[model samples]
Target: MSKDRLISLDVFRGLTILFMTIVNNPGSWSTVYPPLLHSEWHGCTPTDLVFPFFIFIMGVAISFAMPTKSYDNTTFNKIVTRSLRMICLGIFFNFFGKIQLFGLEGIPLVIGRLLITAIVGYALMGNFNAKLKTYLAVSIFIIYLILAYSGIKSYEIVRLPGVLQRIGIVYFIASLLYLKTNQRTQLLVAVGILFGYWALLTLVPAPGFEITNLEKGTNLAAWVDSVLLKGHMWEVTKTWDPEGILSTIPAIAEGIIGVLIGQLLNNAKLIRSQKATQMLIAGIILIVLGQIWNIIFPINKALWTSSYVLYTTGLATLTLSVLYYCIDIADYKKGTKLFLIWGVNPMIVFFLSEIIPQAMVMISFPNPKIATGQINLLDYLYVAGVQPFFSNPMNASLVFALLYVSIWSVMLAYFYKKKMYFKV
Candidate 1:
């Protein structure tokens, strides 16, 4: 095995994933301030940036990590095995990662705070047949629309193709597309998907979709999802799903953007200064283009709008460029020990946050009322320790999450010292 070192790349990935944990597994979601909340319908927020940025970073990582030459059987086998593992893990999270397997006897906890789980399944799974995936995806929605129009059932804890599932489907094709086609074709395909999605949203009126306006309840995407997965829609958005069919068009761009970054990173001959400068310029260009696109597309995380992809991708790339210059070129390895830890095993911490919220939240001291029947360990600490003195729930929650990050950082540092990296 070739053990190549890319300090900046690992650090960038690590820092992004580490912040992902903090924003994802806070002490209390409701208690979080404005920056954490995803924009209600349109616009951006710190929370909104997390997922797309993660995806964008994945694109950057994929570009840097893909082999430069022809694949050998040994390398091919490893890639296949790892890809299969990622796909299965994504499925596990989808079906059972939500339910705390053991209610009381075992270490019971919320398996996942968020419903989106398609990140890995798509990225790794190869789309053997582009036609089949598109057919299946379309078929599922058509069947769902028929059922939904029939008013067969009310929405509840029903599951269907979602963000992760979409990723699996689109990613398979996108990966194949990346390998099978050239760069210009890839860019064209990306643009086509984006515009195609927009046109569909505007032209085809969903059931209950009016000629005047398609509100959240009546939006084409939500209507299609509800119709298809009648009994399987999420409890929260009975009328709409964030990871709906039409919405995924823009989502594919997220993965495609990754492929683009991967391509950029593939040029090994480019000097560090050249790479950094290119990224910074690209970031500036994207931010401006995103703003222009926002006039029509509306940069939305829920929809994963095209503008949103450009805006977030640009930021992610620029950030990576700066970090590369600082960490890899300038050689600042002091406090980076923390980020390097997360860079080692990000998914582990992500899973842990879901597996054990109490630990992530670091619930201590006296517990307080959080949700309907839940009182977090962290809440107790906040009320009994900080709330008595401070009044900001948001600040307290941020502090709590940061503290959790720090504790985990210590563990990560230990593993880093031992030179261990647990990958998916």
Candidate 2:
């Protein structure tokens, strides 16, 4: 096995997470710029690529993190443990600020704060234990389930599919494929999955929906989401979710592609130049293939269409290739420090980015516009600190997002300095 430390992987993962934080935490969703927001329905946008890029990064990171030649109980336990942690975290996030009962908003906020405090206390004590972790995980799930199901009559609360949960699922599948098969077989499997998903979505007529229709809720993916997930879809659209079950088939293909690329980069026989050239060639080929397929399938992030997978994965590959050349091959390391901080504590920063905003939103302050009403701390911070300065709402929103990312970066730097890294 190659002992080469791929600094580019960390930089790339950090870059993707940084963008994800920016896109997810804009000052005001209504005022966000065009490029920062996802596309209305079809076609690709910069924002749409962030999630898939992170998943691709996970696949690449797996190649480095996991044992390649062996499959055993230890490996299986590791996979299950990491995946459950992620899924539990996802459930916590999904219910963080959303679960309120009888119009009492403070209940969920209190629960969220208590959860954060417990985790912080545990970290400070440095007494992490498997039994304690198991109990905590089970307790969190039970609490979330109660809160989620409790408000079903008056609210739309249900067991929603979360970003972390989806990542955990996809990560497990991708990791297993990497462990069980060689790179060539993985590549073939990826192509076969994409082709199969394309056929399933395009050729088969969705029950009670239009034939070959790929519209918002009319597609087969959406139908499956509705039937299987029922009230557990995205809050924005109860009928369908962007990270629904069926769409994950093609999403797994993206991870497989990442694993294949990671394996190629891991080859000790290849020189840095050869590795970079191969990735560049592969990226170009995939992009061309994606574009050609887009004509027939229509690239849609919500659907996680085969074309969308190919195009986004291609872009991720090209991006990684550039970073690999500059950072690993050329030894240009100075500029990657900020990304490195974020990369090292990606999960920690991401969880904080989400939980902080949600917590802040729960604590209300005087609304400047409405004499009788109030706004959350997050909204107040954006309006008072950033929104008032710029005439353009979009500019203000973008600046707020940048400021949010910077705040997290500062916190992450402290952790980096302390050599405190949080994984999974």
Candidate 3:
């Protein structure tokens, strides 16, 4: 396979992150479009597709990075270090939004810390002068230590298993499997994982429950999460985490499926058109099989059900195939730059996206128009700037999300122009 970067893959990744930013950062959760909202329990929404699509893309990336090769310490260390970094960053995300520093508390503290974090992160992660980067990183670290030690308390229970944490874990396992096993073995392992996870959830009952089931907060996955994670579970449903331990088994399968597809795309013998057609056919088959399995398993994103893995991966494959045909095969590259920017620097952008909103919500001011008499920065923007012009609240909310996305797009476009892609 050629070492040149895949424009189609980059565009696909960018599109996923772009939509993710929009759906995740809606101006008002109450006013979000139904399609943007996650299903309350068992089903898929456009929003639900975002996380799986990312994981699948990560798998494809792994295929590109880890060629069929012999084992070596450097390769092993690279995989371990990268996985650890992502996992640590995920945990840091949980802590950063909550940790109060130097009595500042709330929005100001979060925003300030994040700004420092960005500077230090850029210095360390970006291509910069080694000495200067080291000095800047150390100085920032010492300053953060002083502030953190002073008055950083009220650190609430943080959800341990999150989107990035799961991504990290899945990447580590999938990368290893890719390195050690052949393509057929990888495919078998992927299929086996889905079947095994299905059997584990359906046939085995939790300690307290009388029978195996897939009910919310009471299923085997939830029970395992409660047993292991305990207090460190999702705040929305303290009983379980969507990215829980048991559920990650199927998530790994999702990554492996991506790896397989990546291998197909990377096959030099097959022309681009043939690769696209094959992926399209494979996507359709998986979608059909997923629907058939949905009768029993029921495609559930929170549970990361086997059917959900199949369905979402199928959709992701189909999406990537179309992009491959249009961008790589046909060389039709109009409007691809927009997503390419966000795609190249997805991690940093996603991290900022999460924290910015947290800080905005924390920083509130008096608003007499609302019954609460107080409104956060984000709500204030929507209420005063975006809401007045529209009759439908949902439309206003969507516009705010779009504006947020556009701002980030502009910022990322500059970074892309400067060739400053942050890798984590």
Would you list the rank order by lDDT, best first? 3, 2, 1
Clashes of each: 12, 0, 0
lDDT over C-alpha atoms for residue 24 of model 2:
94
What tens digits encode model 3's per-residue C-alpha lDDT throughout 100-191? 56778665676777776675456545655544544544454454445434453444366678898899899999999988998999999999
Q: Which stretches in model 2 have alpha-carbon errors above 4 Å?
A: 1-4, 98-156
In lDDT terms, which candidate is top?
3
As for TM-score, the candidate ahead, 1 or 2, is 2
Stretch of 10 with least lDDT, candidate 3: 147-156
Report the C-alpha lDDT of model 2 over 221-335, residue by residue, as the tens digit. Answer: 9989989888877879888888899998898999899888888887889998999999999899889999999999999999999999999989999999999999998999988
Provide the TM-score for each candidate, comma-separated. 0.76, 0.91, 0.91
Model 1 — TM-score against the truth? 0.76
C-alpha local distance difference test of each model: 0.63, 0.81, 0.84
Q: Per-residue CA lDDT of candidate 1, range 1-424, in tens?
A: 1256567767777877787778865656778877867788889987787777666665556545654634456544444444334444433443443333234222233323222233332332334354443443444345434543444333124355453455454555556566556778888887887777767766777765456233566767777777766655555776767766667677777767667766766667987778778878888888888889888778877666778878887787788778877877787787786776787676666555543553434223333353435444556655566555546778777887787788888888777778665554
Which lDDT value does model 3 have at 320?
Answer: 93
Which has the higher lDDT value, candidate number 2 or candidate number 3? Answer: 3
Evaluated at residue 291, the lDDT of candidate 1 is: 88
